[model samples]
Target: MQQVVIIGAGMGGLAAALRLQAHGFDVTVLEKQPRPGGRSSVIEECGFRVDTGPTILVMKDAFEDTYRAIGENLNERVEFVRLDPNYRIYYHDDTHLDLYSDPAKLAEEVERVAPGSGAQLARFMADSAAKYALGMAFVERNYTQITDLANPVALRRLLQTRAYQNLYRQVARAFGGSDKLAKAFSFHSMFLGLSPFEALAMYSLITYADLALGMWYPLGGIYRIVEDMLHLAQQMGVTVRTNAPVEQICIEAGRVRGVRLASGEEVPADIVVSNADLPYTYRHLVAPEHRRSYPDARLERMDYACSGYLLYLGVDRTYPHLQHQALYFSEDYRANLDAIFRTRTLPDAPSFHLNVPTVTDPSLAPPGHSLLYVLAPMPNLTAGIDWEAAAPVVREKLLAQLERIVDPDIREHIVWERDYRPTDFLHDFNAAHGTAFGSLSHGFFQSAYFRPHNKAPDVDGLYFVGQGTYPGIGLPMVHISSRLVTERILEEWS
Candidate 1:
């Protein structure tokens, strides 16, 4: 049997282990944290269990595919609840719009926001559906060379959909120049840590995937999927070790030997797959001589995704009126985005995502209580903003917004509270630049074939999986990445 060692037991790592083990390889998963699930981990306090990252789940087919690859059924293991009116968009002028998965209901809501724009939305979705189909053709496969991505058929589809254009411009034009509708639709790109104004129109596929494919929530939380995968991997004879931080990837004669753990233990393997942040893996784990392809200079020059200020609160009372997911857009959406992406400064009025999972699963919190998870996109550590000082200020601003929008005196009902900052991301996950989303941003040059390949270019027997590699960012994309890397490994090593 071929021996395989995977670093960081994240969603990508755990899923890959299951697939590789099913193929008769000896797989071992080492996690730095005490628990599995890197960003998708959980936070428990005062009888409230909250997911630390990725509250919304879309493109569930990707997840189902992962399970089917291992000869298991996803629905049989994890319970999924579809969310209606996926997101409630709260605007600056005290107006709100609900995004629904049902086409007829969505059309009604779009018409409510921008009259006579229902037809325009239908057109936009048609284009979005095309983009999704075309984009997934590239996303679901492996890329060995640039020609694999820029071939004749792909180029023709790219031109046909005009997916190379700017995302915000396309949405704005499709909505007949309605800024509200444009922002509401294009904001999906922000999850990838790119401003819609700057991201490519191909990203509108995210909006289509969310609305058309529908937004789903696993009953226990997003972490429940992680738990299930970990359980299955262990049952399949994959050894999982927590609190095992890898200090270095040992390479000799241009080939990976194994990995050195923080405790001075070395584990040997025929191959090593890293689920760590790509830049961090290159910079910190691989020695200087072994990483000619990704020198420190090139890593520094790479664009990283924005970080986030996360506030988790377990309140003593529940607000039944709040939806499972909601978003608050600042009056100056452009300025708000500029503050994070361009200027790398704090916004005067920050936009935020609010999630009250107790609305969907009250069991997450104590009886009759609620759990609130607030995330505001902020500049990554490159901005040099002192999070120790900025966290309190950001928390106050978010609470103030919550008080005004959701419930009055919201702060008073808090029984437990905790916050995570950019520094925490750096410390906990060793994420380069303390990026909260994927470490690498999804710029035009940093996507698809342009992104780092799953197999290492310099070192033999070293590979990468997760958001930092191709098919970048988001839970669904990470699941796809796992399969891509697993296939690559099997083809080469099996």
Candidate 2:
């Protein structure tokens, strides 16, 4: 058996390990953190168990495919509760809208918010469905050359669906120029760390996937998926070692030798797969001379995704009125996005995501208590903002907004609180630019065939599996990335 060494036991890394091990490769997964799940880990304090990373799951078919690849059933392992009214969008005017998975219900909700928009929404979803079909054709494959993506048939479909248009404009035009509906739908691109105004219309595939396929949460929290993957990987004879940070990828004679741990131990292998932040792996783990395709200068020029300021609060009081997921859009949505993506500064009034997991699963916290996960998009570390000084002010702003939208007495009910900043992402995940989502913002050039390939162009036996590679960001995309990379490895190494 060919020995394989995988770095970072994240969702991508863990999933890749399982597939490789099931195929009869000897695999060892090394994680820097004490526990598995790099970004998809958990935090437990004061009787509160909160997921530290992704809160909800969408495009669940991608997840099901991963487990099925290893001859395991996903539903048999994790209990998932599909959320109704996927999200409650709180507008600046205090009027709210619920986004439901059922088409009739969603149409009703849209008409309630933007009168006469029900018909427009139907047309928009049809266009979005077409975009999803065209986009996924490229997303589900590995690109060996530009022709794989730029072929005539694909180009024709791209123009026909107008997938090349700007996302915000497409959604606005679809909804008869209703800014509220546009904001509600187009904001899905933000999860990929791209501003809707700048993202390509093809990304509406995300909006379609969210509404059509539905949003789901595993009963125990998002961490439950990670825990299940870890357990399954171990059962398959895959060795997983935590607290083993890889300091360098050892390459000699233009081939990967193995990895050098931070503790000075060398684990030799025939192949090495990295799930670390792509740019970080290239910049820190791989030596400069070996990075012909991604030199320091080129890496610096690459656009990174936006970071976020996160607050995980364990409240002593339950919010029965709160939906499982919610969002608050600032009055000036464009200005808010511009601050994060253009000027690279903190917004005066920020839009944020609110996740109340305890609303669906009371087990996440102690009896009579609830957990609040708040996230506000912010500029990446390139902004050079002093988070130490900015965090307190941001925290105050978030709490005040919560008081207004949820309850006036919310401030006094806190039992435990934790704040995560871009710097924390840097220190913990070695994420390039401390991006809270995945690194590498999804721009026209940074997506599809333009994204980094899984295999190294300069060094042999070196590969990458994660958001930094193609298929890009989100838990679902990362899962597909693992599958794609596994296929590449099997074809090449076989």
In order, what lDDT does every prediction score?
A: 0.92, 0.93
For candidate 2, write residues 55-118 as lDDT tens digits.
9799999999999999999999999999999999999888999999999999999999989999
* Candidate 2 Cα RMSD (Å): 0.9
TM-score of 1: 0.99
Instruction: Give the alpha carbon lDDT tens digit for every residue of 133-174 in model 1.
Output: 888988998989888976677677789889999999989999
